[model samples]
Target: MIGAYTIGKKAVTFGYKRYGIPGAVASGGAALAGYLIVRRALKRSTNADATGVESAIDAGEVKSAVEERGLGAVTESETLERAIDEEDVGSALDMNDVQSAAESETDAMTEGSEGDSSDER
Candidate 1:
């Protein structure tokens, strides 16, 4: 009976050891596949960033050239036309006037409230 039990245990151990090899291979394959995918994605992102920086430098150079040539030197249909568009300084001053008027009215209301409370006392 003892000998039979020992043989049964050995058979089970051998079965597990055989299957373990395939399990290890599958794990290693998955890890390697993930590494390759991530490496490819990083390379593509780096290339896109380099291209964007180059384009920005070109845009800055064009703007600088327009400024140096004076507004009259710029042709009528160029991008410089949009850059030199007039801003309404008068309307900005009107906004400040409106804001000050609002603040003065609020101060008056607070003073009126205090005067009424004093009269009641």
Candidate 2:
């Protein structure tokens, strides 16, 4: 009876040892896959945000430069005529919208400059 009990105990231990290796391997593999997926998603989101921010900064710089150089500074009527001639009738932007956007950008730039000057004092 003692010998039989010892054999049963060894068999259970052997079974557990045999299954444990594969279980541990599967867990590690799953963890690695999850990490890779999250890492890739994070990288893509970061790249997209960076691209959007860069485009915004570049647009602001161009607008500021144009304002400083007084380039294409046309009256509203002239701007309307030019837009009508150059763009299709179905174009989304009208003369008034363009003029208002330009005015707002200039205002913002001037405000920023004034703040900087004040800081210097």
Query: 108, model 1: CA deviation in Å?
Result: 73
Best model per lDDT: 2
**Given candidate 1, what's the lDDT at residue 10?**
39
Q: For candidate 2, what is the lDDT?
A: 0.35
Which segments of candidate 1 are over 4 A away from where they belong?
1-19, 48-121
Specify the poorest-scoring 10-residue window by lDDT in model 1: 83-92
Candidate 1 per-residue C-alpha lDDT over 3-78 given as tens digits, one digit per residue, 9 for 90 to 100: 2233234333443465675533433332222222222222232333432322222222223333345222222224
Candidate that scores best on TM-score? 2
- Model 1 TM-score? 0.24
Window of ten residues with lowest summed lDDT in model 2: 55-64
Instruction: Determine the backbone clash count of candidate 2.
Output: 0
